[model samples]
Target: MPYNIPSGSQSNSSGVALARSQNWAFNPPSIDVISSLHILQAQPAAVTLSVSIRDMLASSLATTHSDFNLGITLVQDADALDLFALSSSTHTISNPILLDAAVLLSMQLEVAFVDPTILLEGRYSGYIRFSITATNNSTSIVEEVDLREYSLNLERTGSTTNLLTPRTVNMAYIQGGVSPVLDFDIIPAAASSGSLGYVLSHQGDTVVTLAGTSTSNPPFTLITGDGAVSGTLALDTTIWDSKSLGIHDTVINAIFPDWNVILGMDVNVAVFNAPGAIVAPDVLEFSTLVPDNPQEKFIDIFSTNGFTITAPPWILLSQSSGVDSARIGVMPIDVSNFIQGTYQGMVVITASGNIYEVEVIYQVNDQLETTIDLMDVNFTKDNLYLQVNGYDFNHFLQVESTIKTYDIAGTEFVTTDVVRVPFFNSSARYDVGEFIHESMRWIKDPQAAALGVLDPLSAPARGLYQKLGFVDFNLKVIDRRNQTVRFIRNLNGTKWAPGRSPFNDSNGYHFQNFNDAVARITTEGFGIINIFSKEASSLVLFKNNVEIDSFVLNGGDLPSSRLLIYGGNYLPGDIIKAQINYGTPAIPQLLEKFFVVYPKTDYSCHFLFRTSYNTLEILQCTGKILGFVEYSRQSNTVLKNGVDIINHIQTNRVDPLKVNTGFIPEDQRYMLDVFKRSLAVWLVVPQYTQPIPVSIESTELSHSDNDRFLHAYDCEFKINRDIDEQIYLF
Candidate 1:
């Protein structure tokens, strides 16, 4: 009241009354600025002032204060507010008294979140004080200073001591006695002073060893912490040897204050054992042997521990018994003097202090009790026909012969042992051993297994006969009856001879003026017809210019010399007519033709057949033809045929005959080579019908004496035919 001043500040009675209030007089007017600020660790804290001078003072005083101003000061560490610098430390308060006489002054001061200098973890203190000042013209300042205290409470909700993600520690493939390293990796989330601890838990192939074992001492030096957690796990593999041959699954847990991570470990150990056993075969039995030339048999012996051999002279050991495998061969010592009886012996195989016994048993036979006979032997001036006695035998009859079948155009020659032949026993039939030359013929029907009383003409029997490469055969019967040897040879000539002809023969008939001869042939109930060559051959039949049926000739090597014309069924005086063709001189034609005929047929008819016919004529002279031409791929045609049309024909032909030939006897091979040198010394007959020259094809070692004498060998001869000339020569 220092002189009731006539001023705007004193005009409001409420302002005067507020100044008189004892509570306002005793304490500085201030508002609660902020409570304890809870914040995340490593984050800043902030406060915005809600208290104003107008709210701190009475409303009349706030409205009366025209020049009121607010002053704000942050009292704390200088670096406290560095994280968020306050935009301004002091600000002017806007007075409403100047505009409205009843309004109170209300304003705000903004303060940003500030980070503490020390990175305070718990609670940090700071203060913001606001002061009011007035120009004394109208606005009144009730309080000089207002203090708002705040505290920042930093709580560690997240941790800095973080453990890296855990992974598997694999102790890769290990051997029973080997030690390998267990490898893994780890990294700290950030720089930390804390250490990581690992605990290993596993069983079997994997184990933890201790430094020492005692009643008072621990078995292992426990690995509490390695200071470092990222490195290779170097471990001893010998630990796996304790329990080998399986998988060891283990876990390694990394321990830390904040987290625990488990790492997996798998250890696989393999088994390795030492070697030591003796192995041997069972009993060895030698069934039968021909005393003249006995064969040897072998029994095998093996051992893990090396040893030596102890055997008789008759039992030959391939090698001295040792760690490796060896063979024991058994053969009769005095085979030449062995009588026809059963023989027994023993063979001892020893290894690793172990002995094995192998028994040897055999039976020797001096001669075979079998027989063969040539029953129907017919000899014509041009060819000879022979029938083998159909009597069956218990054993095979070793056959060694050459066969030759004749026609007008070509000839065929067959040698023994060139193909697998079949043998017939009382019960069943079996193909002869690959290189064995044996013959058999079942007196009973071959198809009897299917068809009772099987016909000899049955297709099955005929097929089997042809299948064994034996349409017909001239075979030698040695050791057939009481071992009485019989010699058989196939001859291709005008008469039966002891040896084979060097060349095949052909029919002697020259065809010319066929068109003129057709008229005369018609008067003789025969008419000539022009033939055309086709891929396959067949004939059409007609009676009195009326179309009848057509028939195909059975394929495969038909003889050019003989032609058979027939219908499925016919009656006497049916007066059948037919036509056929061979080939013209076309570029791609396969074979040439000859014009000839037998008695009742027109001789001028064209006759054609492949040059590689199984039975074809190779030589011809005067009124006779010699067939029985056999071509062998092993015959060395280059040396025999001298690269002519015969070589070309044989080269183009497929060899259906597959035979396993043993090594030629050394002595016989040398003799054959010597004889081959003197070409004139050879007896090669001249071929008159085949226009192209023929030459010796082969001089092969003969198997005729295989059973009787091992060293005794004979030489067989063969020749190639000039089938290209068969076309015009006939």
Candidate 2:
């Protein structure tokens, strides 16, 4: 039977039931990752719950949002409270929400359709909400109501992808101890022991949970004894031997004692007070063969008595003192600046009133002779399998970097784990774009977004294109072949926009592509033309053999990627000429005119050739072939009849229209340079002329540039008619 509304004259006999009727806020979810918000409510009767969940377990980028609001109603009838010990009832979305493999959340929310008139007939008033767990389900969700049935207006910004994950929540750290005391700000202080229930876990951030009930005598009701409903719990985990290294987490599902419905949840993590120990190498050693190459080593430190480190004047240490599980980096002050020699120092450590000494050694070894080499191949394509090929390579550590957070460039520098890519022998190749793309996933910048709208790069980072601009890939290969550690670096990876691809799903546009001039272009068939390079380089452009403009850039040595490509209004057959001059001071000197894009005409075809030479050229041919009838003015006026002399006429043959290469560059001896296996050639442009198929007449390719001119050994694309030419009219 429906209970009458309580007035000044009417009151419930049970104090526990009356207190729940008055208290508004409910406990949160069991797993720390999933949070709850009240979306619908008919005070003391029911509440519509929107469950906000955070998921961090991801191997790659994904776009999706999580589940529906749950509904819960308290036992308001005095008769029901008197007859049965019922606290609340679960309505739609009544099934337990499984958080992970183990952790499950019972009754947390509800939007009830009851006899009461004010049952929150509308949807959530504020931000749009949906029902679904972020975790892929074991079964389909039971949809009890059509969302539009309530006639509510809601707008979703794109799809909720990468919005609630890849995030690190700053949480409070508590030291793990036996019989540890815990305090909570439970709303209305959960009045009685019968009002709450819980579940427990040995781990923390993994949500660190599963389901069922825990019988640990951890009091959530008045453990402090100061107030009747004090939110204190002295977890007497005599059986849970949790005092060790790392974090100890617990998952508790707060429920209505004997009911199947859970009113709320609680999760807590107690960090380990690193057991005192001396975790350090007997000696710290650093050595390198390359000049100015950085070398690094680490020393682990964790002490309950607190610790302090003292190093020699020349030795550099990351931290002088610490009290928890941490790794302190030991590096040389100036290995590159100093000449090839051996330097030594000492690192003294004190912990738990005990002193230990570590011998530090730094050596600048003579350049070692090795076959491992980082290829000097320049590419504009993204994520096309690339590698560092050589003898004896087991693993690789690719360090991706970007601009500083506070600097004008607007980015941050980040490091990677050496062990993540373990090197047993040294052959390790990583995806340059994927690494660059992954680094930008972190929101390290503190800069705020414009207006009230959050910065796209700020928290809740969504989309593939991040706020930070570019990433410079520097790979370090640790070759441990000869029972010794040797570091080889492949710093030639100069990929741009690590967080971008050729086509973006959100923007629905073609962006990056494989255009050699668009140096940063990597995506297939989508490139930005007539754009400037991100590096500083020299380029001169001409149109129709007329000089347009010249940019002679220098001074800024590093690859700023600021170089621009402009062809002086480069149009089809515009004689777009270019002279490119760029090289680091470390590389040999060179200044050369690259090539010219020639005009297109009938009977034309292009070929693609890639080589080490600096010059490029385009070959073309035009004019008509003729056939003459027997006799005519050249011959005698023969074949003539009686009265007059007759003449013969010549027939003109029209050429077929062909689309061929516009430019090519080859070395002077490239014609006979058959010994070089590095040369590559392809029929690059205008490949789709249907009736007249295009094919290269010669396999031997050569080129002529301003520097190395070679006119012969040219590979011209000859058009083969798929079907015989039906007509060649004059």
Q: Best candidate, TM-score-wise?
A: 2
Q: Which ten residues in a row have the lowest lDDT in candidate 2?
A: 10-19
In candidate 2, how many Å is residue 121 off? 78
lDDT of every model, 2 decimals: 0.32, 0.31
Against the true structure, candidate 2 has what lDDT?
Answer: 0.31
State each candidate's clash count: 34, 44
lDDT of 1 by residue, 347-397 (tens): 777765777777766565433332111211112111222222221332234
The list of candidate 2 runs beyond 4 A from truth reads 1-62, 65-483, 492-693, 696-698, 701-713, 716-730
- Specify the poorest-scoring 10-residue window by lDDT in model 1: 4-13
